[model samples]
Target: MVEIFGIAVSMDPIWLTLEVAGWTTLILLLLGTPLAWWMARLQSSSKIVLEALVALPLVLPPTVLGFYLLIILNPNGYVTEFLRLFGFEGQLTFSKTGLIVGSVFYSLPFAVQPLMHAFEAVPQKLLDAAATMRANAFDRFFTIAMPLSQRGFLVAATLTFAHTIGEFGVVLMLGGNVPGETRMVSIDIFDHVESLEYDQAHLLSAMMLIFSLCVLMLVYALNRRFGVKVG
Candidate 1:
């Protein structure tokens, strides 16, 4: 970062990426954990429909997600008007908050899939045993399910963070390339490339590549260690 023409120039988008991705992963984990657990245990006819809705973003084009969010979050949009009753104006898009939301939607699969698998992997026998011992649902979840699913949780978190770090279209659509706020690493690289700044683009790209590799490696190592422990 440098001060140029009375404005700060930041070449490091990693911090911003982490900020958006971190909050996104945090929110996803908190929200997704329960939903995933519920979904995993669900046996109703609507299970497939709900599962498809949750996984829709994975297959949807990032641009499509961004475009719809952009329209819905515009100042005069329906959602914005709905928020006006509370003495607040809608300003989700074109800000860091929108960027985070975009990241979360884009990275939902990274958060949900692992958790669903984790919940599924929990032995029904153990849960039955806990229930027989008079443990409530919450107790069973905390004592038996969560602890055993630590590896999946870790992997989900790491992948969500990494995936969000590389987000571009959604961030661009929602954030509009605002620097130091919504211009995440991927957007930064895009800006550099557009400006013919190959060196800067390479620097940011390399950082992203390294960060993703490290996160994946860490997740794998943890999974291996936990697998051995479980075995």
Candidate 2:
């Protein structure tokens, strides 16, 4: 516990939040990159449907998403039953794993949209030139598309990490509030307020505000420095 303005505050939630954010960001980067790449290159009309599905979390209420996820991840849920067939009977809901799953879903758009735009922004002419050189799609993506999309990668990672850190509804609904396991910084602040610990809540909220502002500032600065136009 650390004393802030004479109030003892536990740091467990902060560390746990960072841990979850780290995992969520890593998983999104790995999974979203390929999905974004595929979506960006698709020429069919179905691309719109795919994009809408990927972007659903952006418009959907967090509680609604969380509620559905809870159903899917609970002890008697299909996911658990399927895992049991493979001798894995561990619970997901009310655990850190549930928090990570919910965060990944909630933050999917933040990762995918920017990456898709970046992949789209890669000049088709450049890809054509690479194709002329006998470079395969896999080689071209790694050597050309990925290098050109570095800025987008940075933005995606920053946004994903920050968004995960600030997650509340999904984490709350799926993981509940288990200290040192699933309790995130946002939930900790909420708890403080609910307990009438105004000083602690204010302190935590202020920290989050400052951190979010700094992340946005950094993203904008990098974009401007790299001559990337933001809409």
Candidate 3:
């Protein structure tokens, strides 16, 4: 048991939550960067459709998303079967992997929306100048676009990490409560509440509230400092 302010509590969920948030943020940064770049540069009428798809998670309920993910990652589901074709023999549902996947999906908008705005805010003139200097698309992106959008990257990563840490419904539905394997802080708090452990629940809930407030404050401070608009 870990003690927080003289209250006994398990640290497993805390560590697991950090691990999931870290992995989700890293994966989102890697994948969202390219997707955001593409979306920012899109000039076709289909851009709206693609943007809507990317932003779907924002409007979609976490439980609904989680329920679908549970189905897809189940033993006999398409995702599990697809992975089996590559010699993988592990289950996704009720596992840490499932939590990370759900977090990534649930927090996709937090990662992509900021990044897209940042990429879009990059000056076309700068990219055009880079092109005149024989810079390839990759070079222009890595050098000019990425550097200009540094604040956006910060916003995206911060929001994604914070959002993932606070996830409950999606994680619960997809990963269930498997103790050290899949029980996150949110679920742990839920368990405490269910078992009539108000003291423990209050402690955990207060911690979450404080942590969430701090994260939001930090994001807002960054937005002000860098003049980046995060939505």
| Candidate 1 lDDT by residue in tens digits, 162-209 | 888888888888899776777777887888889987777776677678
Better of 1 and 3 by lDDT: 3
**Each model's TM-score, in the order given?**
0.91, 0.95, 0.96
Select the stronger candidate by lDDT from 1 and 2.
2
Error of 3 at 61 (Å): 1.3
Worst 10 residues of 2 by lDDT: 222-231
**Candidate 3: Cα lDDT at 144:** 92
The clash numbers for all candidates, in the given order, read 0, 0, 0
Query: What tens-digit string does per-residue lDDT give for candidate 2 at 160-212?
Result: 99999998889889999988999999999999999999999999999999999
**Which runs of model 1 end up more than 4 angstroms from their true locations?**
2-12, 87-90
Error of 2 at 190 (Å): 0.9
Off by over 4 Å in 2: 228-231
Q: What is the full ranking by TM-score, best candidate first?
A: 3, 2, 1
**How does each model score on lDDT?**
0.84, 0.92, 0.92
Candidate 2 structure, TM-score to reference: 0.95
